[model samples]
Target: MLDLAHRGARLAKEHGSSAGPPVSLLDQEVIQVSSADVVGLPMRCVFALTAMGFLPQSAETISADELIRVRISPAWLRLDARFGSVYRHRGHAALVLR
Candidate 1:
């Protein structure tokens, strides 16, 4: 999903989105990943979900429009044959404990 985020960051950068590349979401979790894990991930697909996950809930409420407003990169979402869960609000700062 980060690939999407990076792309979105770039798109936002290029298209003049008032929203930044989504530092709000990026800063939410404490990442416990290695450069190796990042390498293992399909960068395009992984960051698609990541892009959505990091977006802000409008009026402090999560909604589908808010959820779907930001589209994940098609190339990123379609490349994988496997799946994983995006865990949120755990006891610690957010992390993907692979």
Candidate 2:
């Protein structure tokens, strides 16, 4: 997940967009990690990001079967350190916002 975040930050830097990479990218990353033991991880990722203010609190939730869907905004990747220790590992110290 931190790798994905770093990739997103790199992409944002390349594109010169302060908002970070598209939410779909992060969503795809989460989906890739989804498994029996990691069910609903995407929702949890969204919730965590939202809680950290990386994502907006007004995100809409959609329920389908056993899965919950949310639209991640472009502004959801501010790279703020307040987001948590996840960004601190994996050589991502440079990506964190001071």
Candidate 3:
């Protein structure tokens, strides 16, 4: 997936467009990964972008999948941050010890 995204980003860059890469939908049966797990891909994508110096350290995850779906500028890797927010917010919340 990362390879695909890189290739896509390269193409977009060569074309002098803000668009990144083509979106790909993996088959659950073939990949054997749940939808919940699938969500991680976006986060990884963001991390990849960050690693590539595309975004800053304070950068947050947006809806990359949606951005790809909407045909908006693909330069930014947007993704649903709800899953990450859940864990991040929980860590800040009061911890109840049973």
Root-mean-square deviation of every model: 14.0, 15.8, 15.3
Cα misplacement distance, residue 83 of candidate 2 (Å): 9.0
On TM-score, the stronger of 2 and 3 is 2
Against the hidden true structure, what lDDT does model 2 obtain?
A: 0.38
Which candidate has the highest lDDT of all? 2
Query: What digit string (tens of lDDT, one per residue) describes model 3 on residues 1-98?
Result: 33454544465456543444333321111112233223223333443444454433342443355222111122231332323211112122456689
Instruction: List runs of model 2 lying over 4 Å from the truth.
Output: 16-31, 34-98
| lDDT, candidate 2, 1-58, per-residue tens | 3344445556546754456545554444354332233222332354345445553233
- In TM-score terms, candidate 1 sits at 0.21
Per model, how many backbone clashes are there?
8, 0, 6
In order, the Cα lDDT scores of the candidates are 0.37, 0.38, 0.33
Candidate 3, lDDT over the whole model: 0.33
TM-score (all chains, Cα) for each model: 0.21, 0.27, 0.23
By lDDT, rank the candidates, best first: 2, 1, 3
Winner by TM-score: 2
